[model samples]
Target chain A: MTRLSSAQRHLVRFTLNGKPVQGEAEPRLLLTDFLRQTIGATGTHVGCEHGVCGACTITVDGELARACLTLAVQIDGCELRTVEGLAPAPDRLGVLQAAFRRNHALQCGFCTAGILMSLDHYLRAHPKPSEAEIRDLLSGHLCRCTGYTPIVQAALEAAAELAELSRSDHRDV
Target chain B: MKPAAFDYVRAETLGEAIEVLAQHGGDARIIAGGQSLMAMLNMRLARPKVLIDIMRLRELDRIDSTSGSVKIGAGVRQAALLAWPELATSLPLLSKALPWTGHAQTRSRGTVCGSLAHADPSAELPLALVALGGELHLRSAGKQRKVAAREFFAGMMATARADDELIEAVSFPSGNARCAFREVARRHGDFAIVACAAVATKDGVRFAVGGVADVPTARDWPRLEGSALDDALNGFAHELDARDDVHATARYRRDLVRLIGRDLVREVLQ
Candidate 1:
């Protein structure tokens, strides 16, 4: 078709946490809209409606992707992890989250979810990134409150905690 | 806030994607990461009637170094390029320019082919690729052709991509050469207002400046040293046709062209 076509595409089925969920959406429907409106997973917030804001961030098949900029139809068989799915099970406040809370990393809580999600991945990839590296990585995210000191501290503390845990595990070995 | 409705086709293979493009024609858009495409789609700036999702194209997602050149698949993500080892040793300029991309999260999904295809005049990768003398492999339904980096970039947001054609890969020649890049932008991760990539080869010095002119302008000066080099650079700086944009003025960009060009060539080459 010369003009854009709207089709009632097949239901998109995917896993949230360990459960399978299905929903119907058009090719143009955004994954953020699908998550918020369909499943009511409001933890993934929408800020810029573009990829600029980290608020609508989520983990698709373990990789961080902006839900706001992704199409719902694209996630047919992928596994998604949202903030709601993250909690004490991975250890209370999840290390990064707990560190943020302990260090008072958030204030207004608007950009926290996105940063938390992104930091989750960043910390996993780089357990102990330097103060400069933390700042460099966090440069991808926006934090309006805490002036980034506390957040950066939280990330720093999380790295230390992760290092300790790694040492403990190695000692156990 | 939502993108316009479009016909979605998840191509199972590269041939299918090309066929779909041939049938659907110009209104069809191929999306890899959708990092750049989705933004334009949402703003209604790009309302492609047919959206071809090429995320599953396995062939276009490879990065391999063969012979002396590095063959980066069109779908090779930006993060992949940053992680590639040869590009670092063979072309250090590409490595240095990697951080100037959008961000880590965006780089995780953004593809090299898409960036070259989008051909933003001021972007780092394109300028680096041009300076390195990369060859873009463009594939159509029945034919595939390679265009040199010098001829690939037409202008701002413009490239040599043709209708019913897709970028197969981009290959840059390998050499024992030194390279450097300098770009001044509004913010750290923001697009460049003016960027230049300079290559110091055994032959001579090549200077390519983007975000200052319509298309990338390259100049190869006769090897000069001392005051002669400074005088030539000053003359070239005064002769550029820079434009005024929201980020910078024509005058500021022109001066940057001279300063950065001189800085990179003199420091890296000399």
Candidate 2:
């Protein structure tokens, strides 16, 4: 292995949530670490660092990506959205998060954030997904506590809520 | 787990990337999506002295179709390829196989060329590439060459690519062939114990199996119906002599191969 000095840090600038954020990171620093440590977006949890678990999932440039597998430098100019960005207000939960809570989707809550992020991205593209489609989307995420039934229920409810919101937005337009 | 300390260079263009690869020799590893490489690095399975970040090589991130053939550049992510509107009509086999490659998040960051280069025996991309009979374009500092997919994979986690050569693009011939991909994994997104891809064209049918051997192997079969195709696949499965591991016994894998092969062939024929 080639040893770089501990002082080595590269500057990365990217849009976090709706704000532009910049930080110094090692080239090998993962995007998960960058979000959690440097920018203090700790809502993006890290379970399996090798990209198996979806705990470190986030959206980069409107696409769902595994933060554990992405380098901080790779998203220099990209827009990123972590779990923290899910809520419309600082204190209130987003539609997906509220549906997850209402449906008892989380037991341990460790996997909830990742699931929320993934479902948020999926539901954006598929506003009214079926239960089977929700289950297929959740297959990417590993949830040990919820037995996946409640999580799937949460996703289905969230999809319904999102579809309603889209319809209302269109009506308002 | 974190990756070991290494020098990182973001190559701007293909020529520059090839120069860096040539300069570093075997000490460097090229990273596009970094899905597989990051996992290997975190596990200490790969210890490269230099990481050539080819993610910025936008010139290679194109999917071009010309004369009934599609050329996908190395930097093209799996999800991007899947999202391509023309992919379903141009390369139906790849379109059918991409969803099984990984989850949405991983596919968003994993590149098609990266999967081909990683060369895991259980990986779906290589199996699909072989089944589709794709061609890999490799480039060095001063030379470029195209290799057939059948000859690209050497063994488990090994390929015919030279240390200095960079996979520039992969090309697949376009045809309206009926294709099907089937795999038996422990879970929805997990690696398959045995996977098969079958494509039936007017000429003949081609079948490739993964996770049963060191590398995905493909065989051409004549158009046969019913029990004849099943018997041929059964014979082919026995000839594979797949290895045994913690996940499954060699016999189980062979059986899976035969079953999946038959199913896929039937789907293609229909």
Question: Which candidate tops DockQ?
Answer: 2
Q: Relative to the true structure, how large is the alpha-carbon lDDT of every model? A: 0.80, 0.86
Per-residue accuracy of model 2 over B28-80 as CA lDDT, tens digit each: 99999988999998888998888888877788999999987899999899989
List the lowest-lDDT window of 10 residues for candidate 2 chain B.
Answer: B5-14
lDDT, candidate 1, B116-206, per-residue tens: 8888777777887878788999887998999998889887777878878888888977664677888888756667888888887666788
Candidate 1 lDDT by residue in tens digits, A1-173? 12224766558899986789998888899999999898777888888887886788788888888888798888989999888765756445676778888988999898888888888778778876899887776777777777889998998898888789888884210
User: How many clashes in candidate 2?
Assistant: 0
Q: TM-score, each model?
A: 0.92, 0.94
